[model samples]
Target: MNCKEALPLIHEYLDGDLHGSEAKELKEHLIACPACRTLFKQLEQTEAMVRSLPPVRVPDTLTAQIMSGLPPMKKSRTWTDWIRKHPAVSVAVVFAAVMFGSYMSMWNDDKNLMVKGNDLQEVIIQGDTVIVPQGHTVNGDLVVQRGKLEVEGDVTGNVTVIDGSVNLASTAHISGQVTKVDEAIGWIWYKLGEIVNMIGS
Candidate 1:
């Protein structure tokens, strides 16, 4: 094995997780390569020293304080048990009530808001205005086609702007490059194409 391959396998060898054949190959390589042998010895010594350190003890007073601060444990009941005990009609009624309560909780949120699904990691702002909140993360592409983007969050992928402005907060992080287009038509077309591609996927 070369240095690159053997380097990665070193950890596996130390942990005794490598297959017998792979271990033997690594060992043979180590025997032939003095540099690798020296590195392996250093790594082994470091591991040994770390393992020899004693575990820390938690103070009795601190442990007692933590236990006192915790709430009392409640009896656990399975959802299956609860459902089985109720009649079909009663179960349906309960389910509807729960769903209604869940929707009602979000009723106060602005109706104009559009929060993308989990899979839609990429987002393109195509309107005249857009707002991205703090701590929100976009895992894929962020294309500002024709609108304003106020970002206080992170974008994991590329950010592109076309014929519009983007206002970035200090907290914003874009992992990929930012590109801009000059014309409105090109921006709209690109955004539409991206949306179509997302839907097809």
Candidate 2:
């Protein structure tokens, strides 16, 4: 057994969820590995300290004070119970609502420049231009909306520029395709493509 596997089992053991062979294997790993043994001791001490603390009970007056503005009501089930029973459906509905809100705000004839990407740590933002500086590395896909993209360094994924210009320097290194979208329809398609990719992933 390795420390990687034993680490999780240590938590399981602390939670009293581990048993039999899995627990035995973790014990052996802990005994063989000095680092794992030290970590296990620390976690064990933390757990013991936590268990030693007394349970907390919230005051009823505090709850009433927080709920003072709300009208008194009887316990009701309907939508709340339905949501509880169908959590997946509720989650999908909420996600769709939030996405719709974001879409409306983003594409409602606004001229504000926006940039979206999973990795923008290496990107430098100027007034109207986004620059990937030389010698810096952008680790993932980059999207520049209503602005300019000046690429001089390494980009590990796709680069998309919308309603803007992209200037690639001689030393720029891009591992994926680069696309420029100009028209409103093209922007819509780009957004749809992003949504599809997000869902697929």
Candidate 3:
């Protein structure tokens, strides 16, 4: 198969969704295609890094709020009446869902907090390095005054940074260029020290 046809199948191959013969065909194609091999490796690494982070437990209160807002109903009521009776209830439920979703969307690491695709207004890369993982498409520009950056996803807008280095991942597709400045020196120093300690250990 040609590269274009084989490209979409790569995901299936990695997911083990292919039949034996199909799998063999794709494997053979990958061996001959350098670009596809590199892409496969990058995707594998991204998945591994994302999985390594501990799962964030949704707060009990938040979960309770969500469940409570959802409020189970009796089977007797009609759909229209249920919606009419719970007009406020429905709105509350939707709001709660948004809150829960937003909380879960953000990724917090020791060095920097990477926010996944969300309705984030602006991002300021202060002290530590912030990484936008692959497959996370941001709606707006990433504003970093100072800190390291790794963008693996597509940003719909421009990237502005003051004094930090942007290390774009091979799979990254940025729609805008990066801008830098030199305001947050203390944070940078602290971040550098932490990075050094981590490397040494």
- Per-model TM-score, in order, reads 0.31, 0.45, 0.32
lDDT of 1 by residue, 89-153 (tens): 22233345345531110000112222222212223333345555567776665655445667777
- The alpha-carbon lDDT assigned to residue 158 of candidate 3 equals 66
lDDT of 2 by residue, 1-201 (tens): 877777677778877889999988888898889987866765564455334322222233433553367554333323233333333343343345345532211111123566665444466666667889999888777788888899999998899998999999999999999999999999899889989999998
Task: Report residue 184 deviation for candidate 3 (angstroms).
Answer: 6.4
Name the better of 1 and 2 by lDDT. 2
Rank order (by TM-score, best first): 2, 3, 1
Question: lDDT rank, highest first?
Answer: 2, 3, 1
Candidate 3 lDDT by residue in tens digits, 1-201: 777777556656645577787788888888999876766664444334334434333334444554474676554443234433454443343345356652213323343344333333223233366666677776655655335777777787666554667778899887866555456775586467549967998
Give me the displacement of residue 53 in model 3, in angstroms.
2.5
Deviation (Å) of 22 in candidate 2? 39
Question: Which ranges of candidate 2 are over 4 A from the true structure?
Answer: 1-111
Query: How close to the true structure is residue 167 of candidate 2, measured as C-alpha lDDT?
Result: 98
Instruction: Tell me, by TM-score, which candidate is best.
Output: 2
Candidate 1 lDDT score at position 127:
35
Relative to the true structure, candidate 2 reaches a TM of 0.45
Candidate 3 is scored at a TM of: 0.32
